[model samples]
Target: MKEKKEKWYKRLEMPDAFVIIFSIVLLAAVLSYLIPAGTFVREEVDGVTRVIPGSYTYVESNPANVLDLFVSIQKGMIDTANIIFLILIVGGIVKIIEYTGAIDAGINVLIQKTKGRYMVLITLVALTFGILASMGLVANAVIAFVPIGIALARNLKLDAIIGVSMIYLGYYAGMVAGIFDPVVLVFAQTIAELPLFSGMTLRVFIFIGMILSVIIFTNRYAKKVKNDPSKSILGNRPFNDDEGITNIEPPKFTVLHGINLLIFVGYLGFFIWGAFTRSWGINELVGVFLMMGFTVGFVSRISPNKFVKIFIEGARGITYGALVVGLARAVVIILENSQILDTIVNATLVPLQAMPTYIGGLMLFVFNLLFNFLVTSGTGQAAIVMPLMVPITDVIGITRQTGVLAFILGDGITNIVAPTSGVLMAVLAVGGVKWTDWLKFVWPILLSWIVIGTLALLYALVTGYGPY
Candidate 1:
């Protein structure tokens, strides 16, 4: 008997993360040849680069060649090495903690308490991550939570996608809300010359809307998968369920487990404090993670050799996620080198400037969403885009606060779906989720966020959404 052929659309499959990213890098390089290059005048302010508003001028096109593509990859890798290594180290640390059965035992205790009320657990976890993210949780910092999320998924008999959504969505959603995201909020507001975290009443509503959307979406999917295991996006089981928490009986929470959990919690608290107060970067955080790992290893009574072995194993498991960060960064390298990024920004903004007040406000959100695909760094994009947005907002008869909101919401919401977002890719990689699978599961939530963000931007434009 002959089998029927699948439809052409059905036959198509998205490539893995590396291919998708590299293809984009290639496209960016090619566009350099076709598009005119331009740049904005930039000056060093307090040791940081800031683009001058109205400084855009066409420069000679410097298209990236094939050789440049390879060079950019190397450059990208070097540029993001700190983030790359931090992921590996955090992986090792998490593995060490996991080997002690501390995560299992602690999660087991919580599982029992919330046995039938998993949505409550989901809501609490989502809110915790979201709130922390708003308070200034960095993207790479979210990596440390991925493994724990997967473990939670296994315990809940849900798919890895659901587990990742609970944490990843929560964090990114909060970031888009930008209620108090120090990196994006403070930088954009400062650049726009608005009061720091000013207009937060609107942002608080964004924060709540985003977090609640995450909870509701995550719960619905969790229920669907729970009722029918076959409906899982990752298929009947998971991508890598070798240490299946559901299959094995959870170990009892013991004194050693309690100590390990306490140490872990304490480390996170200290790290958050240091991150906000001391302005800890990746290197500083790595040192602290190492210290936490060794302390937990010693307290868990893991022998030195055993600890080394487990740490290596954990790091090895996360190599896929770690390496992809550089690959994603290569896209930015190509765009910056080609000098077309500013040209694209200039071209996009000109049309918006001609738009009506409310339309321009909504378009600002749309532009940021598209622009984020090329420049994913929050502060970096702010340095490049926010300067231009301030003048545009004034011309469009909207508050600068409105422009800042558009910038943050556009940049933050698209992180969920943007191919150029290294953090998003890294999180999915760490979660043992395929890029395609995540896209399929996340599109609806992404749409909901887009709607919420667009409406908010429109409201801001209409209300002159600002204290400034």
Candidate 2:
């Protein structure tokens, strides 16, 4: 009876990927419509501010109309298209390098060198790559390492999921820390009206700490997956593997490998120099990656025709990922237009304002967690939420930096389970793990991390870690 019940629960809980995604989109649409969102007018007389009656008006132009909705959808499509193009350009170059056997040879050498501590070596590689990814070379890093991760997993008898998770989580965790993160830096600095790299010291410290925690946690979880195949976290019944297997010859190591290696190393060195020196902007870094790809592709001896195909294929694969990004953008657009976002922020802040500082910080932390699902992009969320939060923090006597920290904490932690996160889906697809299965394996750990992160943020607030 217990076994049957467990089976039933597992079966029922399995998320149909399409259905899950569709439901989320539908929910967002419903919320956009049902939530009262419109422009509000506040009149200030003699330094006193009051909400004038009937001042809150639903602007007909601003409501979620057919044209606006269509435009939003179109915008989402365009965003996906741009991402796909970028992926193609980058993926193609990486694929050419792989074809030349450079990456595989490098991994083989590393594995041989690491010997018995391959797991630790792989973890470190993942962490290093994760940090690099946070610096905005994400696509290049992912394309470069995913195949290597798969190879390493096969050799170590570890689930490939571990490698995939390591890369995804590491990058994301670094993103959460937001130290010199282009996305975070631009948005936060703009909204907070602070200088770029203004809070560098503390942001770097948080970034390092978060990266370490991710490494530790992901390594432990992955080790469990490696050691035990029977532990069904999400009740993912093993599927028949007859259909998905593909057979391709592994590349033979040659002189091209050496040339490709030089190219890769040179590119990486330049990137590191650029990052540390702030010698280039994010766009410039992207240009560097493009140059690296072209150089490596040529070195790999990939024929022009084949190279073009590889680029196209890589780009095509990312179409869905880009679409997800666009949808995320649309959600943000709706939040912005609806005016409900302000209301939600004000409502949350009003009650918290009366509380003690620590308690208020805690409230912001909790609010961030809850809101993260709706606003998946950390930078975008900050843009929408921060302005309102900064004012609220001023009113509540909490520092703006505390508000930023809370936003970071909330935004970063939720990506682990957020259905809307493109990277989560990408990782699952790359690892061949089902969505439901991943959530089962990940949720408990992520939830615990959120609590820990929240505590950390509260500590930062109490200690006045930010510019008060």
Candidate 3:
């Protein structure tokens, strides 16, 4: 009956992220009653909570009732409040920039400026946006850039799908590559009890490689489509003029647009500086974007009331992702409060203790890949998985840094193909590409990531990459 129901459910569309996460929270609560209750000693390290090994002990089973399950979602939101608000501020900034016509205007100038150098345009845009995404500042925010990319591709006689891939793939790669992505990197590292941003050197190289692969893939597809239109993934599916491409003259490059572009680009520079030199956290990151939103709105002469409306709408649009992050937290809360997380870890790890180190690390990488399809939010993935895996890796002699690496790699690679990934589907819809076409096009890249990542994990294990 359970298998039949799951198959029937699979035939239906995925539920809301919140619903899926909440269900997992309930399932975890149920497991607490079924599994023996246990915990590890914990202590503060660098102002973060960490489980102390060799402290595992059986505890009284404290099962949650239905009421406790219902309230854990609220607790989830409260715990993830910092990240949830950070997402809102960033969303508002992107929305106001869209309202200002700056995003379109800047892309218009880019198309005009880079005309006839289609490869240059693809490489430049992909790498630039990829870098921004790597910093965790501008990944989902690229939704607004999708139409602009399609417009540029159509005008250049390239496939609309290539245009969308340019943004989505680059961001996805950077996200998984995890160079300077504060949200995932900080969450995973802190949970694993590694120094913040440890193992940056290896990640930077991997980041460059992934960015380059996207550039190559996008450029190749773009060139093929440029040479033959019928071969385009978007064949015969007519795109509307307002979808961004038209016979009308592209918007003129004006002084106001130029200043707005400078401000946008200049702010990125300022952000990078602050991030590296000043050790900026969530608060500083949010403040910078808040200022960017107001500055762009004021400079473009958007009325304060209209600006307020846009900001609210922007925040509202991203509320789903923000809330899902918190609701996902409830899963962790349920497992922790039940006092059985360490038992799950130890029971699983003790059996694998004798395995070769590289294989053990690869197992983690593979586990993260499978786990990511279910929990798509990077923050949430870290919140639940990292704590369980951290001690297991220590017991098995795999470094915490390697564990975090596997988690991110596994998490990122699957998002490209997972139907459960809201962002992937959302990006495809914005680009007018079908998920079927995307899957066919993306399989090679995904396979390459798996191979490369497994090798990287083995290397990290052999080298004992650490700040442990």
Candidate 4:
């Protein structure tokens, strides 16, 4: 019955694709306006409660003014530029690696050894490298591995979508669960004013658990698709035999391959050492990636001029993603400047204040999920929400750490499907899957993960894991 229902739904003709995309965008815009601001009040010894003001004030007098719109647009453009520069630098290095076939060579060896159990291979590859990609080298991990995933799936008679989904699942799970992720860690710690690395042990456990769950779930899902072609998320179309599994003439492993391998190894080793030792920061990691790209390009006999061309190509691929990030940031800026963030929060949480502390934590978890769609960056969202939440958590008798944990879960889970998330779109494009198709496949998986994760958050509260 379930299978028949799914098949029936799949057969229903989708409306104009543009309508679906437009509706989603319009819904996001509507939600941005409708969601009330979050605010909290402080009490004095005189038994009077004061209403806390928000960061930005909503302009009722001149709502449709052109000057204000221009200023907002300008700020959005500047933010986009900043993000593009970062993407260009990172993408350039990864492109050089790709152009030289270093990543392909490494993946080929792994695929050859794995042979028949392709699903296990896909899961393992994603889980192992996903964590590595979280450390500021965003584009490298996805660009290098996603194509390999597609190729591998083709060979196994599996749909390319499964491989694409697993690969991204790994990257995103790692990005969100990262204990040392520069953006997330810095954002959370700075906002909470806690010591950097204070929550390392707990975070590490969560990261490992999530990674394991992803691998297990991905493997099971992929296997089901393999056994039942009709179940394949990308559709059970026959594999294209013309796309050869191996290069007709595999590139000979030369001294250049060895050199490239060493460069890759050393590049990752330096960051691992720095993270474990707490000796460096995100800037250092960025510097290392830039240096490694050039080193690998030169060692692989890529001429400087040609290497620059590859860099340009790679940077071009990320331009769309960069723009999405910028536009998403604009929405956040508008909410911040309008002081509407407080209004949204206060309206939502004030009624919840009478509830138990654990309930308040649950409320935050839900709020974070919705707000994250507009503010995709974990660190940025934390800065906006934590201050308001901390005082509220105190009043409601929840620990600050529990509040932060809720923020982490909320911020982490939404990135997987959030339309504003550049990484999500990048992964989808690389895998040749449409955004709607990807969403159709992963919605159930995401919902399941959220339910499990929420239970974990509740457990933390019950056990008094942090200061409540």
Q: TM per model?
A: 0.94, 0.75, 0.69, 0.71
Query: Where is model 2 more than 4 Å wrong at Cα?
Result: 1-13, 40-74, 129-151, 179-209, 228-252, 265-294, 308-323, 326-330, 333-339, 422-437, 464-468
Residue 383 of model 1 has an lDDT of 90
- For model 1, give the 10-residue run with minimal summed lDDT: 1-10
lDDT tens digits, residue span 15-114, model 2: 5655576556555556667776655466554453434433345554344665665576566556444443444444455556656677766666666678
Candidate 3 lDDT by residue in tens digits, 348-377: 544555667777778888777976765677
Point out the higher-scoring one by TM-score: 3 or 4: 4
What does candidate 1 score in Cα RMSD to the true structure? 2.1
Error of 3 at 179 (Å): 6.8
**1 against 4, candidate with superior lDDT:** 1
Instruction: Estimate the TM-score for candidate 3.
Output: 0.69
lDDT of 3: 0.73
Tell me the RMSD of model 3 versus the true structure: 6.6
Query: Sorted on TM-score, highest at the top, how do the candidates line up?
Result: 1, 2, 4, 3
- Which 10 successive residues of model 4 have the least lDDT summed? 238-247
* Top TM-score prediction, candidate number: 1
- C-alpha lDDT values of all predictions: 0.83, 0.61, 0.73, 0.63
Per-candidate clash tally: 0, 1, 0, 18
Pick by lDDT: 3 or 4, better one: 3
Query: Mind sharing the TM-score for model 2?
Result: 0.75
Evaluated at residue 414, the lDDT of candidate 3 is: 92
Worst lDDT 10-window in candidate 2: 237-246
The alpha-carbon lDDT assigned to residue 377 of candidate 2 equals 62
